[model samples]
Target: MHELKISIITVCYNAESTIERCIQSVINQYYSNIEYIIIDGGSSDATTGIIDRYKGQIQRVVSEPDKGMYDAMNKGIAMATGQVVGMLNADDVFTDNSVAGTIAAAFAENGNDILYADLNYLKPNGNVLRKWRSGQYRTGMFNKGWMPPHPTFYCKRSLYDRFGIYSLDFGTAADYELMLRFIHVKKASVFYLARVVVNMNTGGVSNNSYLGRIKVLFLDLKAMYKHDVQLPPIALLYKRLSKIRQFF
Candidate 1:
């Protein structure tokens, strides 16, 4: 059971400022069988340089231009050779080193197809801006604006084989669309790990500005429509409202 191979992928494009910490967190994991793969989007900055410094520890490194983060994620998925797969973004860090092993044990023991947990949204100075507690997942939760923190979500590689990888159609909300498709649409099995597993940086593309939020809403509505989601306007409202709890 301890021998289950888990693939961890990190996608970056000119993320030199924070990529090193992200890489360090993955390499520091005590999990014996982590296949660490880095997908670089032909960064013109020193991002590739920092990655190069860890060449011996990293399993696979692909430096080239890609469509976007989702496209890069698909490339990493294709390159993964593990029984379970998860992603850690360039600007994100695991809450602790044990996170990888904890995830592996959960999969190796419980036999869940999808697993996710809590997260902390951190400001630039490393202050906690919000605490994302993904307490539980139930049918119809998505309509009420509920979903797992994607950074901590891990699943069997076979799930992607069955359902499909991230879709580019959703734009910045592809992660949201993918979750809606897999858990809600296909009804895959999931487990909640309870513990906080990731510390994500604030100010992602979607919430970066008012205009950005509007664009994401348009894309999200389109995704909800494709999945036959009910009361999308209300769902979107619920989704935004739910985030308020994170700041408390």
Candidate 2:
């Protein structure tokens, strides 16, 4: 195994209730070469205090204000010093202790700069609510509105140097935009690690309310137009309807 140093970033704001669980998951990773960084959005809650409990395990922690989640992620990316970088939300976690090991092995097997996999949506009681299985990436998949879950997405630091990081202007669609730009436009080499990798909690900001969803749709349309990703009106309807299958 290539013992690649992997940096996992957890961006949070006022996540006192779940930040510790997220931190524990990272600290207990079976892999040895792990760098954990936490970026706080000047949370008024006890989030930073909770993070302080694991200061020894965490390599770095930056607590300050930011424009939004994507901006906070940008800061974390700038601080990353590992060959591979991935994000673990404050409310989500690796599916197992060897998750990092599995990721390292996949990157070692092929010269794939980008790696992503399936994810499980968890209920508050720790039960699986839904499964997001991201199949292999094929050419032109983005046009059909296919996107890998951001929490399970990992890529070499060099790709960011070559392309770029999350765009603040894209808002909730920033993750979608970045993936489209990388996989479809720039044609970065990628691999799909066909297994559940992270357990993402529900109630993410973008899906919290009807208004949020509407905003996401507008931003997504903007991104698709800018990248020249053809999203036919019928295809857009199918895209929204397809998510229903992820649920039970």
Q: For residue 26, give model 2's deviation from the true position in Å.
A: 0.5
Candidate 2 structure, TM-score to reference: 0.97
Largest TM-score belongs to which candidate? Answer: 1
* Residue lDDT tens for model 1, 84-190: 99999999999888999999888877888999999999989999999999988989898887888889888889989999999998889999999899999999989
lDDT of 2 by residue, 82-105 (tens): 999999999998889989999988
Q: What would the C-alpha RMSD of candidate 1 be, to one decimal place?
A: 0.9
List the candidate 2 regions with Cα displacement exceeding 4 Å: none
Candidate 1 residue pairs that clash? none
